[model samples]
Target: MIESTTVLVVGGGATGTGIARDLSLRGVDVTLVDRDGLSSGTSGRSHGLLHSGARYAESDRVGAEECIEENTVLRSIAGECIRDTGGLFVQLEEDDPEYFEEKRAACEAIGIETALLDADEARERVPDLTPDVERAMWVPDGAIYPSRLGAANAADAEEHGGTIYPHAPLEAVSVVDGRITEATLGGTVERTIEPEHVVNAAGAWAGQVAALAGVEVTMAPSRGVMVSVAYDELDPVLNRCRDPADGDIVVPHADEAVLGTTSVPVSDPDDYEKAAWEVETSIEECAKLLPPVADAPTVREWWGVRPLYAPDEAEGDRRGISRGYFVLDHADDGVENVTSIVGGKLTTYRQMAETTADHVCESLGVDADCETATRKLPGADDADRLDELVDRYDGQGPTDKDVIAQ
Candidate 1:
């Protein structure tokens, strides 16, 4: 039996769910497939710091602007899923002050407010901050959640009447006469999925997915390792006040804190192992910014792969490549009746969805515009009110406390 749909979103992370929700709300038939549970990839393993665009200020202006814009949008819609703990960037005495100054000015020009805080005041808020830290710039848009963006997007897609297939991997892209027709399930799951517009939102696995389609997607895949700590509050999210390198960020999640991460290009994404030297190196490095982190309880360690896309040879400067999105019309590239959305951040999933949906609609000749922006996702409306309740309540039972809280 061949089932057909308007689109196939090929990842279970923030991006795929967001695209499914967007297309479904536009009155399009959409199916979302994933190789594992929701957020099974880099989305679940991230540092959980909602970017304020400050991280990209010195290096990538376009990426910075997109982050700032999406940061505002997600905060407005996914308020309950977020904790507005705010963010701080600390520059150590040994770190270059000029780069810090450049980041501050770039943020200012891009509408990301950067407030310089006194070292003592910074210490007062984040007591663990190293005394050697000479400067701090606070950005107000920082948010942290126990889990990242997957939940909200998943809930939204389901409520919009979209079908979500977890644990289904794409074995191959089935195309006929230079147009994509469908994708076969990778493993024998006793069921198959046939989607019209197949989206390759597979983060680190994007290049592999493209390979199945007989195309090439070149993303600079980099691996990052993170160390998790139990208990102890750190103010908002603490960043190294420089472009993201290794062990430069401390993101507080739930009752615990996570100190991360080291970035280096890798040939494989599933290489999840901790080098004693690497964790020790991270702890030592984090200690430079936050003295106690050198001694902070080391509860757990994990790694993630970020899908960094370089400009196509057919394209020009990578800096000019829009951070917004790349909606490849499969028809224009040899394959017809298919589209792929790839390379963006979890913070900007909504905008990415809108762009992809517009392109899909154009391909399918649909007239309706996307309504994902206006609708409140399921449980999202309950997010703000259910915060403390869900924190204390069990994941299983129903209680009046939950009802009254919402």
Candidate 2:
């Protein structure tokens, strides 16, 4: 059968859902499709760090700036999806004091709030922290729930008249005379979709999706492995005060503390191999930050592939690539009405979507300003609603009935 829409968004990760919500709010007929469910890729596999941009302040100033901006925005609009637990970057006795000073200076230059904490204060905050820690710097980082954030975006999109189809993978792109006309989606339910525009937000698999449309996009898929421990040893996100490297961060997610990760370039997005060394290295390295984690029970482990973008001229390895995203107009490559966005982290998905949506709207002559920044997603006001529920329940714990209303 044949379906039609004003826009077809491939890849139902954070970026794609954000775009669908943005375009739909602007009165566009949008359809989003994904090979798996929302956040089934890198989005769900991440350490869920809602970055304060402090991590990249020195290495990638632009990326750090973007992260800090988006971090504030997400905290405002997506409060329910965030834990708001602050982060700490600790300097061990052997680490570089000069680099620690540089990180603080860079963070201050970018307007990211930084507070230095002495060893006693740092250890008081995180009792499990290694005794050898020299000092610490606090940043406004938080833990984010990927599933909740993506679901909120998807829900808001649907409320605004957008359609989402999970498990529908794009099999082929039907292009004629250098313009995209339709896309073939293959799954249990097959259909050909004729879209006025196609957006590739396929995350790590963006390169493969672009190839289906006969356009070449170079994407370096870097795999990172995360190991989950059974206990939440620290309330704040912990980071090693050094350059970006494997297993430098430990994020507290719900009751578990997630220790991660290793960045190794890979050829396939689906090649999520959990090497024994990677897991061992993560525990050993993260143990330097929190000693309890070394002996904690490892409950689970998984791997995520980052959609690193390095054009031919761009230098350095995957770690050196900027976390900033790219919105490629295939028209520049001789394919019309198709745009592919890649290379951003979850913290800046909304901004990435806004940028891509702006380009798409301009190309189609749609005159609508982006309202996603200020608009609240579905259930975003649930905290207020929960307060009302509390009053209705006379300050007692909410019963199943009251919870259902929310």
Kindly report the root-mean-square deviation of model 1 from the true structure over all alpha carbons.
5.2
Per-prediction TM-score: 0.87, 0.93
Clashing pairs in 1: 179-336
Give one digit per residue, the lDDT tens place, for model 2 in 26-63.
99999998876666778877878899999999999999
Our model 2 lands, by Cα RMSD against the true structure, at 5.7
**lDDT for each candidate structure:** 0.69, 0.84
Clashing pairs in model 2?
A: none
Q: Quick one: best lDDT, which candidate?
A: 2
> CA lDDT of 136 in candidate 2?
100
Q: Which ten-residue region of model 2 has the weakest summed lDDT?
A: 393-402
Number of clashes in every candidate structure? 1, 0
- 344 Cα displacement, candidate 2 (Å): 1.0
